[model samples]
Target: VGMGDSCAPSNNLPYGTAMEANLIQQLTLRGWAVVVTDYEGLGTPGVHTYTVGPSAGRAVLDAARAATRLPEAGLSADTPVGIMGYSQGGQAGSWAAELQGSYAPELKVKGTATGGVPADLLKVADFNNGSYGAGLVFMAAAGQDAAFPELR
Candidate 1:
């Protein structure tokens, strides 16, 4: 399952509430179960950590763990899994891949597919200067600062 872009207030949009029905249907048809994460605080409380790699990665892994424990889903702890994401989601997926070997060794992650990943926040900041995406760069910086004070 893919992590989505941005966070909407739970009272307004509620995380994962707007997922495309067709996408879920296609995955189910292919015999792949799905579980998407709403990130740290998007569907709950407090501020979302946005691009903080470790936080996003942990959220994805935790979702995987939570999915396996649902008795009705019939998923086991040994179930093999694959992850995919794009844009901001891509970065999160990539981080999940890096973290899984250590953070969640019990999880059987078969593979990860990431697209349009912004791997380097500083590079994104430098490259987007004076460009339309410059605003995104600043937001990334702010998110990093909020999530990790040492980086600030």
Candidate 2:
């Protein structure tokens, strides 16, 4: 939710926090299958690639791919996939859906829904520069640097 490996969803006891746990519980209660990704470097090695589109998006789609391939899950390519998220997750989900046509054409994406996406990074940075959320800008910058080491 914030920065660092400690905050990674995978490292959390109930999937990042109470809110995330509750969301997963709600979906599972309705018999809807859900899979959450920790994204690259999160809880694994190196700094998390926080808001970078391609890395997060590829992780989302790849999660779907991994879920459907699970032998015990019984899910298949025929299963309809739906992506949903808010804020950072929203960005990831939307990117996955956008890239699905080429990156994961085989996934049967039924639909996608997102909210509070930081689509315009410059605007978000400007708006939060002097506010309580200002730290987010620095975190995002570090994430960008992590995602594109060559560019840096």
Candidate 3:
């Protein structure tokens, strides 16, 4: 499956509202069933951790596992799953791939494709010269701090 920007799965809006509808349509035409997740907390509670890779990855992978149980997916647990994303979605995809070995080993993740990945928030901040993107970098830091207090 593939994820678009933050508006894609992490927010249950229309394809046009989230990402390019044509892209989803084309992927579907290519015999790929796409499943999107609105992350853990979007319109619910707490804050939207923009580039929190681990949280993003867990949401995507768990959503995939949940999809297997849905009649529309028509997939079994043994099915080889692949994840791909760009931008914020890329961070999520990368997290999912990195965590799969220990987090969801039963999912059978075949591979992952991530583009425009923000692997290092500090680096991204430095590259962007601490602009609005730097705020996102800050959000990532908060997420990491929350996920791992020891790292703080």
Q: Rate the local accuracy (lDDT) of all candidates.
A: 0.76, 0.88, 0.71
Candidate 2, 26-121: lDDT as tens digits: 898999999988888787688888889888899999999999999888898789999998998999998998899999999999999999999999
lDDT of 3 by residue, 20-138 (tens): 45677788899877776666444435455456778888988998889777876788888878898887778888999999888888897888888988788777878776565555656
Off by over 4 Å in 3: 1-12, 130-135, 138-152
Q: Which residue pairs of candidate 1 clash? A: none
**What value does the lDDT take at residue 95 in candidate 1?**
92
Candidate 3 similarity to native, TM-score: 0.77
Clashes of each: 0, 0, 1
TM-score preference between candidates 1 and 2, better one: 2
* Evaluation by lDDT, superior candidate among 1 and 2: 2
**TM-score-best of 1 and 3:** 1
Residue-level lDDT of model 1, residues 75-110, one tens digit each, is 999999888877777888999999999999999999
Q: Which candidate ranks first by TM-score, i.e. highest?
A: 2
Worst 10 residues of 2 by lDDT: 10-19
Which is better, 2 or 3, measured by lDDT? 2
Clash pairs, model 3 backbone:
9-37
